[model samples]
Target: MASGMILAGLGLATIGFGARFIIKQMPTMGQKLAEATKTFPKMDSKAFANSKYYKGGFEPKMNKREASLILGVSQTASQQKVRANYKKLMLLNHPDRGGSPYVSAKISEAKDLLDKN
Candidate 1:
């Protein structure tokens, strides 16, 4: 009976310790969440929804990151490499050659955007 009482007391002490630790951490967790919300735009916002890079849908305006993905090159790829890759992609996806017009157009747009950067 004394052993059972001791075990119960130890369990209560452990729970109290855990509760205190969690309570102490709560403030920091809340602060980090606050900082994150301030640092990034909400995912549901129109800007985020329409983003070509983040949302994974192509847009009329090409972002550098999106352009890099479309061209299969690094974001910092040189203009010459961009052009070469563009040509290769166009050869495969150009509409006249039975490839996707949409894809071909995106490839061209990506090269142009990257060249300008």
Candidate 2:
């Protein structure tokens, strides 16, 4: 009974506020969750990417400038373009699709680094 009343109140709120109810912030919450869940490999797991495409050998922790270079974006590229490039690269480096997980992780780390700026 109380749950129904809460839902009813939510419906009223939707009607009053043009459909923005308590669930309206779900996407933001999901985005934050995704950001929180982003992971990069530890140094213990970093060696031997052995990717067909990556000939650079063992890499250290990614820095801002290196991240921009890894994503193939300019130092001044907008976040939108950075994201676009990240997606494009991920498509080519996704593990199940015959790409390297280490490379994928590095790519993701690069994107996160670039997005921060």
Per-residue C-alpha lDDT of model 1 across residues 1-117, encoded as one tens digit per residue = 999999999999999999999999999999999999899955656756656564547866778988999898999999889999999999999899999988888888889889988
CA lDDT of every candidate: 0.88, 0.84
Q: What CA RMSD would you report for each candidate? A: 10.9, 19.5
Error of 1 at 7 (Å): 93
lDDT of 2 by residue, 12-116 (tens): 887978746536978998998888778654555346565456455535877877888788899789999999999999999999999999989999998998898
Regions of model 2 farther than 4 Å from truth = 1-55
Per-candidate TM vs. native?
0.50, 0.50
TM-score for predicted model 2 compared with the true structure = 0.50
